[model samples]
Target: MKTLGIIGGLGPESTLDYYQRIIALYRERTGDRHYPEFVIVSVDLRKGLDFMDANDLGGMANYLLESIDKLARAGADFGIISANTPHIVFDEVAPRLPIPLISIVEATRAAAKAQNLKRLALFGTRYTMQASFYPKVFARDGIELLVPDLQDMDYIHDKYMNELVPGKFLADTRAGLLAIVDRMKATSDIDGVILAGTELPLILRDPIHDGIPFLDTTKIHVEAAIAHMLS
Candidate 1:
């Protein structure tokens, strides 16, 4: 099997999830106890968020490029950015990479398409929600994606940085997020929810919430990566 490289530590927790899930899934598929050959280049989370704060996407892309180059040098056949927020600069960084870089958005888009979900409610960091990337990708398949209201976006973003990224998943926060989902389901008639942030599934563990499927982007990306590796 081909080796995988991950650009991680966009936040520590989700990156760890990607690593663990990939190993477990690869073993289950191959029916082997041996661990897969993979390398992780954990970037500084603060610096990455700093670039986003300053609106210096070029700088962020360069930072990611440097890490991916290190992955190529470390013998990664292909690579993936383990978090969703950094994918704002994915188009810029991917073309410059030495190895193929799988996209969390594209992977999720494919999964959403497979489920025949026409409308989805997206929840993530302020960066992911405000951006046009997810909408643009899903629009290609005629899927409609919606973000929460500004107030809810504020709540989600605040909790994401202050709580989730630090590995703090509070019960009240989870309830608040679910409340937003319930509201969206009622107002927008959304058929599915896209857990666009990698850390989202860490808190919202269920596959379905009130009959709406929660699209787990991390798991989708891992499955896509494993398929790519085995192919």
Candidate 2:
């Protein structure tokens, strides 16, 4: 098996999910009861959030690039950003990186296509919802991706940073998210919902619930990374 490198701590909770899920899935597949060889470089979440707040995705890309470089130095065979919002800069950074970096958007796009989902409602940080990364990738497969209204976007992003990132999962917050999904169903012909934020599954972990499929980007990306590593 190849060594997998993860650029994590885009927020702490989701990074932990990636680390644990990868190990569990790898073992479940091969049943070796041995942990995989992997390197996790947890970047400062503040730095990335700072750039995001300033709307300087270029600076965010530079921040992530620095981490990827270190992962390369540490002998990582391939790399992945552990969060979705930072992937707004993926196209700009992946080409410049020294190793292959798996993209959450691309992985989710493939999964949606396999499920034959034509229209999807996306919920994530403000950046991920507004970014062109997902639209471009999904467009290639003729999939329609819809985001929530501005007010709902604000609600989701706020709860994500303030509550989810800090490992705070309140019942009220989960209810708020489910309510948003219900509104989305009423307003759009969405066949499924895409949990574009890695932390989202921490709250809404079920794939099929609330009258629509929820595509967990973290699971999609992790499964793809496992295949790459095992192959």
Candidate lDDT values, in order:
0.93, 0.92
> Can you list the residue pairs that collide in candidate 1?
none
TM-scores for every candidate against the unseen true structure:
0.99, 0.98
TM-score of candidate 1 relative to the true fold: 0.99
Q: Which stretches of candidate 1 lie over 4 Å from their true place?
A: none
How many residue pairs clash per model?
0, 0
Kindly list the per-residue Cα lDDT of model 1 for residues 126-204, writing each as its tens digit: 9999999899999999999999999999999999999999999999999999999999999999999999999999999
What's the alpha carbon RMSD for model 1?
0.7
lDDT score, candidate 2 = 0.92
